[model samples]
Target chain A: MNENRNNLKLGIFITLGTICFVAALYLLGAKQNLFGGTFEIKAIFNNVNGLQKGNNVRYSGINVGTVKEIVILNDTAIEVNMMVQIDVHEFIKVDAIASLGNDGLMGNKLVNISPGGSRSRTIEVGETLLSINELDADEMLRRLEETNKNISLITSSLVGIVDKIDKGEGPIGTLLNDNNMALDLAKTMTNIRELSFQTASLSQNLSKSFNNFQSSENTIGMLMNDTVLAAEIRTVVDELKNFGTNSEKISSDLNTIVSGIKKGEGTVGTLLSDSIANDDIIKSIDNLQKGSEAFNENMQALKQNFLFRRYFKKLEKKK
Target chain B: MIQTKGQFQSAKRFLFLVGDIGQFTLRFFREGFHKPFEWKEILKQCGEVGYRSLSLVGVTAFIMGLVLTIQSRPTLVEFGAESWLPAMVSVSLIREIGPVITALICAGKIGSRIGAELGSMRVTEQIDAMEVSGTNPFKYLVTTRVLATSLMLPLLVIFADTIALYGSFLAVNIKGAVSFQLFFNQVFETLEFSDLIPSILKSFFFGFIIGIIGCYMGYNSKKGTEGVGKSANSAVVVASLMVFILDLIAVQITDLFYEL
Candidate 1:
């Protein structure tokens, strides 16, 4: 019994120790997501950026999987297999983009999946997702180099512009450098000041003359200042207004008469509007012009004749 | 001439001692397999070596953990990585400190006990008497004790590591609070199989060295009562030194295989 008790005690101690060790192992395995409803997926990358097996796979900043394997497919590409939890599969889509990310600035490399659109098909077991390579340090450095070149170009151009300005070459430089232009501007400003001063004095004199006119000392002033003269001017303005109204009525009558003539409503209207009458008038004017021309021709013939020439010369001497 | 003769005698003695230990190691391997397997003796030894030494190992490991945490706190806090306390302490304890410290403690406690017990038995002619009584003394004594130490050390180290991590957890909470789950998560996250297996494997070597050294010293002890004391003392000293040496070799081997 004593031996059995000691053995039992020893056995229990050993068992407990072994349990602790195994528990540690189990916990570690669990942390690595070893025992789970896991599904495998593949992502191919031109470069994995030092991503290793057992690195975390995060979705929306939460760890949902682990990198299971990394196989170099060729000189240019590598295939990374990941074991993700099955429950998170609903969140992952076929169009999800996998990219390499770091845990922290100097921490381990992990794969981060950008959640795909809701309308896209969900990712299934063993399906491949598109991988996007992060901008590596070298790529960033290369871009920085280009930016530096551009900055240098801009800076050099700026320096050249500054140099031109310093040399008084451009419009800005001329504005700064032209002493004669500055003096001319100053003289023009002084002339404008004097003109304004003279205009002010002339306005003051005009106001004095207007005041004198308003004192009832001059005829024009009396005409402006006297109440009776003001009444007469108002009466004249009223009569003018009446005459303007009468003239407007006469213009309206004339417009009516013209419109009646256009429509051939009266005798004069018929005469003006009738096309035959207009033809007769044009014929009469033409006959009159012909008679005048005939008369001039006869006079010229008579002057050429000896008898009429002497008679015309005596008439001219009597006039 | 006298000094030369003394030097030559010592050199011969050293070579004979080496030869004797080599032969003893071989005989242990040979007889260990041919056993009416000493399960009972092994159990008793497990109790003696592993259970009895727990307090000493545990206290030392706890102190080591606490001290390591306290010492490493300032540096890690300076780096703003105070949160890494559990992981760092766990790695150091599991990979190196826990195993080596426990093994050394066992060397001092168990090694000395085995050497003295066997030495006293030898000095008192009990081993010879047991042999005369038609029992295989080597199997019953050296094999059981050696196997027991070898088997028990790893388990002890596991216990030590657990206890030390607890101490570290306490120390971590002294300055700041960290949940047990988070602490353990950090620990397991930082630890790899490479860190664990190599350290546990090396403890077995340490155990074997301690057991074999103790057994050898005790078996080859001379000059009666004075020799028993000397055997115990020399066993502890040699075993402790061998623990460090074996640890160095184990680290190198592990690095070569795992790191490369």
Candidate 2:
């Protein structure tokens, strides 16, 4: 009787434990599409990489099934078969795209399916899912390498430009480097300012001179009241003219005498016709040429000398 | 002379320990497969280890789930992901907490009991008497006990996980409300075969270690009554240690395969 009671208690415990186990199994298995109506779909890939069977299959981010098997078709291609729940099969279409992706930032591989074209027909059972290869890490690294090369080239060009700018190698460089250009600019500005001031003063002086010219209290104005003096001046002018004609006749006689002297007609003429006179004239002309050459040499010497330069500067200041 | 005798005795004891445990494990495997199976005894053991441990496991699981939910609430709120609580709790419980809690309870309850009972039997020579009789003591004792623990613990874990999720649902309702249907849907929705299988499988390993360690220590006990106490104590300690070790190994394997 005691054994029977113990057995019964044990039976109760066992039954309860079994029930719990079964319940848990049902819940967990149900979630895995084990107890549900599901359809299978196959997909072919160039490379499955780390993907495995029992990985999730999702459509538009919602998990619909699990990978059932993975097979190698050739050296390059892999085939993945998935079991999707029947209820979600309608979402699969004739042109649905299947690709490998990770679950989260840190998660296992999953098969993600993109929705097919709206105009396309729904997918039938036993039909293959179109496979897409994502931009994997290696491809991303290759792009990064290209980008880095471009960046380096750009940076080197920028450095070269900066070096040229620093060394002042172009027109802008001359503008920056030349001290004479700056001095010339300053001198031109100063001269323009002084010229403007002088022009203003000259305009004022000219206006005053014109006003003085128009005034009646001048010597030119007294000449208008002296008509009788003007008539007496005319009589004196006629007498002077007769005397001027007599002087002209005597001058002409002198000119004839000079010509006879040149011919050696008289005692004075001999002296004028001598070779010593011609020699004396030539000597004077040579002296004049030598003096001019000496002047030119002196001027050249003066231009070369610092003292002469100072004297020229003083002359400029006086001007 | 005394030292030499003592050394020889210690060496003998060590040999006996090895021999006894080896024979016990071998007999357990053999009897596990043997015909005219002791289903009654096995069921009884399942009751003691599985059903009886449920209340304690359920309470602990509930509290664990409640605390995990409440603690995770603030962080989830910060992320504006309070909706993820049900799924998160379910995954955590299924993957780790459920198996560990169930195994721990079995270790404390079933492990100590097996050790103490078998230890007492050893000290009293009752086991020897059974062996001397026409009955096979190993089949009657070790196999049934080991089978009971191995089968019961996984079942217990499943129950514990279910109750814990219920507790988490209540916890979620403390500051907010999620419909029971929605919560359960979310819980099952986020879970996959990967999460379910690995956790369930690890519990069997936990059960095996708990059973074998308890039986080993108790079966090879010495010093009569004092040995019985020591056996019970050591069984709990060693079983708990082995549980942690097995859990570590299971986690590594699960990570290698599931990668989740």
Candidate 3:
């Protein structure tokens, strides 16, 4: 009986140990989503970024599956196969995007899946999903270096512009810094003030002159205001009109006489117009000239002769 | 000159001892398979080595877990990762600490017990009597005890691990509140099949080394009653040393298979 009891205790101890082992296995397996209806899907990536088999696959921040296999297809690409729960496969659509991500800032690498749009159909088993490779540390460092260079360039240019402004080198700088221009502006303002004062005085004088004209204090004002003087000036203008009418009549008579003379109806017209009379006049003028010359010669002879010389001298002396 | 002569005699005896132990292990393998299978002896051993040692193993495991948690708390708290206490304790205990500590305890407890018991039997000529009575003494004695220790150590380690986690759970609640479900969830979440399988497998090796060392020492004891005490003492020393060596090799082998 003691032997049997000992065997029974031994059996119970073994059974309990076995149960604990099985429980541990079940817990670990369930955590990896092993004991479930699952579907397989593949994704191809340029790089897995150190993702390993048994890494979690998450959708919408919830773990849905685990990476089952990773195969390097070529030098540039890799194929990752994931075993996902069947219930979550509905949330993963045909056009869903898969990418590598970290569990936390410094945690394990995992595959993150973004649910597809409403237009996409639900993903089927064995379908290949799209994958995006995460940026490697080297690529991120390179980008950071470029950004640092750009920031330094911008800061240097800004510093140069600030230095130039401080030295008063541009239009804005001259406006801020040139003392001569400010003085010139002040002088011009003073000149404008003087000119405005003179112009005000001139306008005041013109107003005074206008007031005098309105009060009939000047000739122009009296000429404008005296009605009798205006009427006398009108009579004088009437008399000048009568005189102009008489002069016009006399000018007409003179025009008639000039027309008759031009028609050769008078003595002066006959002398001017008759060619025979013109020759007779010319002969008479020539006879007169000859006679005058002969008379002048006789007179000269008389003055030079002894008998007439004395009488001509006495007449000259008396004159 | 006398001391030098004595050193040289001791060295020669040590080499002879090595050869004798090797021969005994080889003979165990030879007789182990040709056995009139000793199921009754193996079962009785299991009761003694596994069930009877549970309280001692349990107390040691609880202290290890409690002390590990209490000690590790300040450091993790400094990093603001106090919540990770369960996972950290679970992984450490399951993967390395629990198995090794339990095996060392067994090496001291069961290994020495087996060594002394067998040494007494050998000195009393009980083993020779069995041999003359037309029975295989090695097959009946060494094979059953070795098999029992090998099988029972792993089960004891599993029990030790469970109790250790419970102790850690208690320690965790001393300063903070955590639900049993959440703490266990965190523990299992951190534990992987690789951590568990390799550790349990190494415990088997630890058990085998303990059994073989104990049986070899006792089965080949000399000098009568004085030899019995020496066998028991050397059995523990060699078994405990062999446990560490095997643990190192096991870690290397596990790393080669899993890490690479």
Give per-residue CA lDDT, model 3, range A140-255, as digits (tens): 99999999999999999989877886898887567567888767768898999999999999999999888787686478777777788789889989999998998999999989
Tens digits of lDDT, candidate 1, B90-148: 98999999999999899999999999999999999999999999998899999999998
Q: Point out where model 1 deviates above 4 Å.
A: A138-288, A292-319, B1-19
**Candidate 2, A26: how far from true, in Å?**
3.5
| Highest DockQ model number | 3
Tens digits of per-residue lDDT, candidate 2, A1-319, equal 8668777776676677678667666876876679989998889998776887778899999988888999999987888999999998888998999999987654679999999998888888878989997787778999999999999999999898777766877765665667787688789989998999999899899877665645544544333445665676687898799879878887888888998998977767866787786688789999999999999999989977987888887878999
TM-score of chain B of each: 0.95, 0.89, 0.94
Question: Which numbered prediction scores highest in TM-score against the true structure?
Answer: 1
Better of 1 and 2 by lDDT: 1
Off by over 4 Å in 3: A141-319, B1-18
DockQ of each: 0.60, 0.36, 0.63
Q: Write the per-residue lDDT of candidate 1 for residues A154-256, one digit (tens) a residue.
A: 9999999988888888887776778887788789999999999999999999999999998856898989889898999999999999999999999999999
Clashes of 1: 0
Measured on C-alpha atoms, candidate 2 has an lDDT of: 0.84
